[model samples]
Target: MVNSSALSGNDTESRETLYQSKFVYIAGIAEMIVVILLILCFCIFVCFNALILNVYFTTPHVHEHARYVLFVHMLITDILYLIASISLFLVAIYAVYIPMPICYPMLNLAALTFRITACNLAIMALERYVAICYPLQYFQFCNAHRANTSIILMWVVGAVPNVADFFAMQSTVEQDFFSRNVICDLSLLAVNPLQNTIRTLTFISTFTLVALTIVFTYIKVMQVAKKAGSGTSSASKAGRTVMMHALQLLLCMTAFISTVSETYLRDSPVMLLITNFLVFTCLPRFLSPVIYGVRDEVFHKYIRTFCLFNL
Candidate 1:
């Protein structure tokens, strides 16, 4: 009876080992797929942004306008955000331990870009509102020079929460905190409860304000479009464009759910990979080229010409 019991115990242990190995194998495969998809998407969008910028800069009539200027700003912000975010993700996933001194600034830069992207969206919406609602004086308020200056102001405003976060991080950590080697992650940098609260509140408030601004612009543009009285009217087109910016903002807002997903779906590795890659990392950044450049009549021709020339 003793020997029989020993054999059964050995069998149970073998089964458990096999189960764990299988899970590890599956998790690895899922991670590889996610990384490949992320890299591919990032490269494609970067190229598209570059192509649009090239066209805009080379054409004087296109580049001189306030709308396209704002559009280019959004593209640049997206690129910066993508670089900071994807670099952090790759570092964490592959377990590249970075010193906190080097990592903190990176995390803060990512946070700042998040705020700036929303600010850019709001500014672009305001530009459209002025263009359609106050056609005669649109240049007075949303001129190319002012658009460039507003981009600078957005950077200043966006840096505020990050500055607060840095102080909050300092309050909790030890004197030698910068000497620690750690996986580069937003969660790691934001480990302090105060930091988390600040991030959550900041995200909600900034995005809410941006969404409201976009919505207001869309409504005003729609009212003007009605008076203009044609399906193909420029006012109607501008309304749709403002609506597109809102849709992009909506994608940005969906990232708020990552917090919820982490809480509930954290244990499911595959779901975590998909959610982080698709929702939190990639989707919002890709929408800018589609919404701003491809959808614009002036830019579309340039894109087509570029594509055909390349072909």
Candidate 2:
């Protein structure tokens, strides 16, 4: 009777282990599905953005200096965003399958690109501000040769800190293992006091500049509209369009802050999920195409022209 009882206990234990294994397998599969969905959405955004930019560039009539510069920067940022999303999706899928070696360098590189592209939206905002605020100075301020140099500097500034933090993180967290399934916690980006300081400062500065740009642009746009009165229908529409873009930019900035804050604070699941929703779940990217397409008279007209031509 004792021997029989021992054998039954062993069998029960085996069944429990199998159940746990199956649960883990299902969870992994679920995670993969989510990741794939994210990748698909990102790819669509990238392709659509590319197409719009191509139309803008190929049509000489639409290629004014201001639009040309904005188009180039938008294309570059979207491409970077696409690449970053791909990298992140791959990392998620890998985490579902295998133990990810703490890839600190790659994590920082991705973070840097995302952050930089985000921050560079400020430059675009600034351009729009100048264009609306001082129409006469627009040509002098946004000239192509000068714009090219500024764009290069913006990217460089965004990329440089990642290189520094990558090495710094390796130095500090190289031996630390947080989880069997974990890759890298970019929260360690704040481990170096100096990097943390600089990052915080950069975030504050970028936020202030972008916020000011939006405020100033709206104020100037409103003033112009008020002056023109009934004759200002076109200008009012343009102001509304810019206001929408500014709102989208605000969403992107909010997402970035939420994600970074959650990471640093090591917040609860609810907090993390909210951050993820803002950062990854099709909100900002969805707005990207809308803001650009609806606000851009050229893009709207050009798409019509293209469709008509094809028809």
RMSD of each: 2.7, 5.4
lDDT of 2 at 150: 75
What tens digits encode model 1's per-residue C-alpha lDDT throughout 182-226? 898776776589988988899889988998899899999999999
TM-score of 1: 0.88
Task: Please list the residue runs of candidate 2 whose C-alpha ends up more than 4 Å from where it truly belongs after superposition.
Answer: 1-19, 85-89, 92-112, 115-119, 156-184, 188-191, 257-283, 304-311
Which candidate's lDDT is highest? 1
Collision pairs in model 2: none
Give TM per candidate.
0.88, 0.73
Question: After aligning candidate 1 to the native by TM-score, how far in Å is the CA of 28 from where it should be?
Answer: 2.5
For all candidates in order, the CA lDDT equals: 0.82, 0.62
lDDT by residue for model 2 over 118-209, one digit each (tens)? 55566665666666667788889887766677777877877776667656555675464434455344553456677776667766776677
Quote the lDDT for 170 in model 1: 87
Residue 56's lDDT within candidate 1 is: 84
Model 2 CA lDDT for position 299: 76
